[model samples]
Each structure stands twice: as C-alpha cells, then as structure tokens.
Target: MKKISILVTAILALVFNACSTDDEFTFVAKPDPEGIAFMNTFLPSYILKPSNATNLAERFVWNEVDMDVQTTVRYELQASADESFQNMTVIESDIATTNQAVTVGELLALAEEAGLDTDPDTEASNSGTVYFQVRAYAGENPATTVEQFSEPVGITVELVEDTSGEVELPKIYVVGNFQGAGGYGSDWTPADGVPLAASGPAKTDYEGFVYLNVDKPQFKFLPTNASFDGDYGDAGETDGVFTGKLKQEGEKNAGTPDGTGGYYWFKVDTEKMTYSLTKVDWGLIGNATPTGWDSDTDLVYNPETKLWTLTLELTEQVAPDNGIKFRANDGWDINLGDTGADGTLEFGGDNIGVPESGNYTVTMDLSNPRDYTYTLVKN
Candidate 1:
C-alpha cells in the first residue's frame, strides 16, 4: 500500500510540472492593428493664372485617392510661398472632410470659399512663390498619417505705369442730322467743317443722319428716313439717305452734287492723324446684294498732307441691298441704325457668300467708344 501511494504522488507531481511548463511557454495573440498598411496621397499638379488688373477669382487643385483602409481619413490643406513652408502660412487650414478620394478642383473651390486668394499675383504680393502641401490623418493618431507637397509656383507682379499723358485724348465731335433723308446720301454734311468739340446731341433737317465724334475723326449714320422702312435702299433709290463726304477746307467750292448740298465723299488726312488708312469697309446697309457699293476709285491717302482724296473714278452707282456705314471710330460698325434683322439689317466685313449665308454683328474694338455694335447682312 505504501509503494502504491508513493507512485500516485509521483504521477501527480509530474502532471503538475507539465502543466506549469505549458503555461510558461504559452503563445499570446498580439493586438490587431486598427489602421490600413497602404495609403494614397494627393498633391496639386497645376496652378491657374489670375485676371489682369484685378486680383480676383483664382484657384488651385489637388487630388487624393483613398486606400481601402478601415479608419476614416481627414485632410488638411496648407500653403506657403516658400518651398520650405517654414513660416508656412495656412491658406486653408481646415478645408473640408472628404471621403478617402477627393478631387483637387473641389479642394480649390473650398479654398476659394474660405476666402483664400489663389491668384499668383495675390500670392506673390504676400510671398514671391506659392507652395501647397496636403496631409492625411488617420483619426487622431499621428503614427498613421501621410503627407504630400507640390512644386513651387511663382509669379512676377509688374507695376503698370500710366503713360497716357504722352498722348492726349483728341477732342471728339458728332456732326450729322439724326433726322435726315435715310438712304446713303441725301442731306449729309461734312464733319470736316465741324470743329473739335465735346460730344452732345445734334439734329439735322434730314431724317436719320446723326453723327457723334470720337477722339479721332469718326461718325455714325442712323437710319431715320421715311422711305428707309429699315430695309436696304440705294443712294438715289429713295429720298431719305445717309452718306459721308470728305472735302478739304477750300475744296467745298469744287464739291460734286449727288442730290445732297455741297459735299463729296469724306476725306481723312493722315498727316493730321499720323496714321495712314490701310483698310476701309463701309457697313453695308440692309441685306444688300452683290455686297459693297461700286467704288469711284480706291481712295488715295496723301502722306505729306495726311489727306485722303476721293480721286477714284465713280462707277455707275450700283447700290447694295444695304448701304455701307461707318462708326465714329475705325474698325467699329455703325450702331446708330437698327441692330436686328427686323430692327436693322445685319452687316459684317467677314461675311462670305452662299453656304455661309447668315447675318453677323459687326464687332469692332474701337479706341473711341468702348463698345460699338453693328450688323451686316446679305440681301
């Protein structure tokens, strides 16, 4: 019995020892990591230019792609003029809370809404160059964060000086009867006789020939003739007319009569203006056929006297369905008459015949009137 008891005790001791050893060498499960291993970063690739003369409405863009991470991501947009971003001014500290993926355009829009000037000029005013950086944070932990930065974008701001004082604005005058015979020429008068003066209201015995002055010699023919009916008419087709004549100070005596008083086609002396006429297109009236009117001859410019002479041979007047007109300034269409197809006939110097058949607004950027709208059409 004593030996059996001793054997039992030994067995029990060995079992206990094995249990202790197993417990000492046991494996433990490590805490599962909460965040993802791979993350995508986004940075701006391009910077947009700013408007001239005004420091408004500029933008920058960035793009970010989310890695199928489990944790939500937060984005921060930081900006600086310096690459180092040492003084790193934050144009947009907290832009928005976006999904794992976001577009730079959206971020830029946010920046704009946050009242940050993305314009290069505005940025340059504060700093020479602009830089952008984006950082993604995994929840509140810095350990699971990634950052990206963009290249340095810089702009050179120029201070524009006003040199307009060198050339003074010439005096402008409007010398035509708004209410005259409204065709091409009926009761038209030469602006040459009209001295340089401030622009104002004027009238004429004829129906629709009102003229306004530009800093340079310019005039506009309004359609106001009874026979006009706002449609195309010839020089001699109807009583109402709108025509321009150029005569020198003493050439009035030699003026040729075309049913109007004592004026020929108008002349512009380049010597007085310092610029020679290279091209001339009278705004065609109505939707005239065959386009332009018959030329007497190509108007010749006298460089010495700066005078344009109407010495060309006048052809048998073949009036277009529309009369050619002029604005107070060169290159601008005459806006005095109606501007719509029904209101006024459309005319354009760039009009082509046939397949491109349509009326076009005569667009001209005149130095005189800021905006001059006119039309040309094919009859």
Candidate 2:
C-alpha cells in the first residue's frame, strides 16, 4: 500500500511540472499605466473641411503598452463626442499596430458626433469637442483578457465646411425692455439688441430665446445687428402670443406673449410680417437618463447665464441609436434632438447617446439665437 501511494504521488508531481512551463499555463499580464500615453503632439484644435475629406487628419501614434511580459496584444482606438466617452466609435476596428492613420473624413465623422457643423444653414453650433483613447488587451479578442485603457485626450473641432456655392444666412436683432439692465447694451436700442439669426439668406424666418422679468415687457426686431434702419414692432394693444401682426413702421413695441413673463421662444416671418411667442420650460427624457422616456427630468434655468442645467446619473445604452432628447413643458410638442449626431439641436431629431455609465452635468444653451447647443460633462 505504501509503495502504491508513492507511485501515485510521483505521477502527480510529473503532471504538475509538465503543464507549468508551457502553453498550458496562461500568462497573467500586469498593466503599466506610466508607460502608456499618446506619443503624438495633439493639436489644440482642428478645422475640418469636407473638401479635404480623404486627406490625412492625423496619424495617431502611442507608446507600446507594457504588459510586463512578452506576448501579443490588441490595440483599439476609441473616439467619442463627449468627455465621458458616452457613445464612442472604435476607429476602423481593433488593430495590432501602434499607430493608425485617421482621415479627414473620419475626423469629420467624429466631429459630427460632437455636433460641430461647418454649414451655416444648420441651426446647430459649429464648434465642439472630441475625445480619444487607446485600449490594450492581451488577446485577439477582448474576452477574459488582461485589458487596460490609456488616459484620454480631448481635441477641439471647428468645422469650416465648403460654403463657396451656398447662400449666406441673414441676421436679425431683438431689443427688449426686459434686457434693460443691459445684457444687450441698454435693451431698447435695436442697434444693441440680441442677435436673432435667419435660417438662410433666402429665408426671412428668424428665431431666438429670451427671458423676461417684468410684466408687460416689450421689444422690437431689426434686420441688422448694428442698425435700426428697418425694424418691426407690435401691431396690437394687448400682448399677442400669435394673433398679432408685425408692422415695420409707426408701430408700438411688441408686448410680452403674456403679461407675466418668464422664458419664451420667439419667431418672426419677415415675408408674412407675422410673429409668435411661446413660453417654454425645458426638460430632459430618455431611456439613457434616469427619467426614462415616459417622463421628463426638469432642468433648472440659470437666469444669469441663460442656460438650462441638470446634473444626473446616466446609463450606457449598448443598443444603437437609443438615447435622450430635450423637450419643453414635459411634452413632445416641442422637443429638440441631434439628428446629425452633431452637438446642435433640431426641433425633432435623432436620439443623443452616451457610451459609459456615469454622473454628468447636462447643459442646454439656447441663449444664442438659432445656434442652439448642449454639453454633457462627466463628473
């Protein structure tokens, strides 16, 4: 019995040594954060042009990820519209090389995710930011592999699309008594009114947002930001939400949509000489947000900055194109979305998304006329 037990122990020892020093034993890789970083000099900002879409935007080079052992590794380049990596796009796909050439078109696509538009006709803001990072893994596939991510870098993207053949958009100004303390230089002066932008040079429709503190506040619109040569004002005695017509000459100032003013959406049609004002209170809703799609998470308005802000935890949606929207009065009648996935807002557009789940500060800035933009800052 002692001899048989000794034989079994010897056999077990031999089996352990056989698998220990070979492929049978998987190597555990340790990540080195200090040695991993971008080796390229990142530009402060890039002005992307559609005309140069096929050109090289940049060659992303990075230091080799130190795994503390000799082994093959996979490299993945990630680009995102938000700092939080909320909705990241893996460039091309996972690769083994330390560097990859990104084309102008690819960068432009990332800029679209950031909501930067060079087109003057679009209502979205023209400047935004994109973030990049490198992910290193030990195996061909990411599953069960030792993986780590490099520190992310942010780049500002300003779009300068080819506007050679396009018509230049027109400009209008709004000067109101509500602005009297001079957020726009002594409110009642058309020359000093807030800029109200037109959709296009051919389209005289102008839109903007404004806040009023006093009851019965009045205002007027000027065709130019610097002159009152042609201005339009109220044609009725009482405040008109939509029924009142605009008169170019010999008219009283346009009164508030309601006697009690808070915030309003302003619109004017130069051809029709018609103006409308709708009081709006903005809210955020979607599956990605805590409120889900059925209800709204109301955003607080900061009168000083004229921005709507909300801080909340957001969930990552792995499914494509499922995200969030900004609506007014907790309803879909007036909701804003980013159809182009650009940082700009359309009345009813595509869903906005995030890639990683985290706490974020969501801001909706409609203070600038026609150029509505929003920001999602991860905390």
Per-residue lDDT tens digits of candidate 2, residues 51-131? 444356778887776675456656777776666666776763456778877766567666676566666677766667666
Task: Write model 1 residue lDDT over 224-287, tens digit each, in one string.
Answer: 2222111111122223223223222211111112323311223222113111112232332223
C-alpha lDDT score of every prediction, in listed order: 0.27, 0.69
Which 10-residue window in model 1 sums to the lowest lDDT?
A: 5-14
How displaced is residue 357 in candidate 1, in Å? 78
Give candidate 2 regions above 4 Å deviation: 1-168, 237-243, 318-320
Using Cα atoms with residue i matched to residue i, what is each candidate's TM-score against the true structure? 0.21, 0.54
Instruction: Record all residue pairs in model 2 with backbone atoms less than 3 Å apart, i.e. clashing.
Output: 86-354, 86-355, 87-354, 87-355, 115-342, 115-343
What is the Cα root-mean-square deviation between model 1 and the actual structure? 31.0
Off by over 4 Å in 1: 1-56, 97-128, 150-379
Residue 224 of model 1, lDDT score:
22
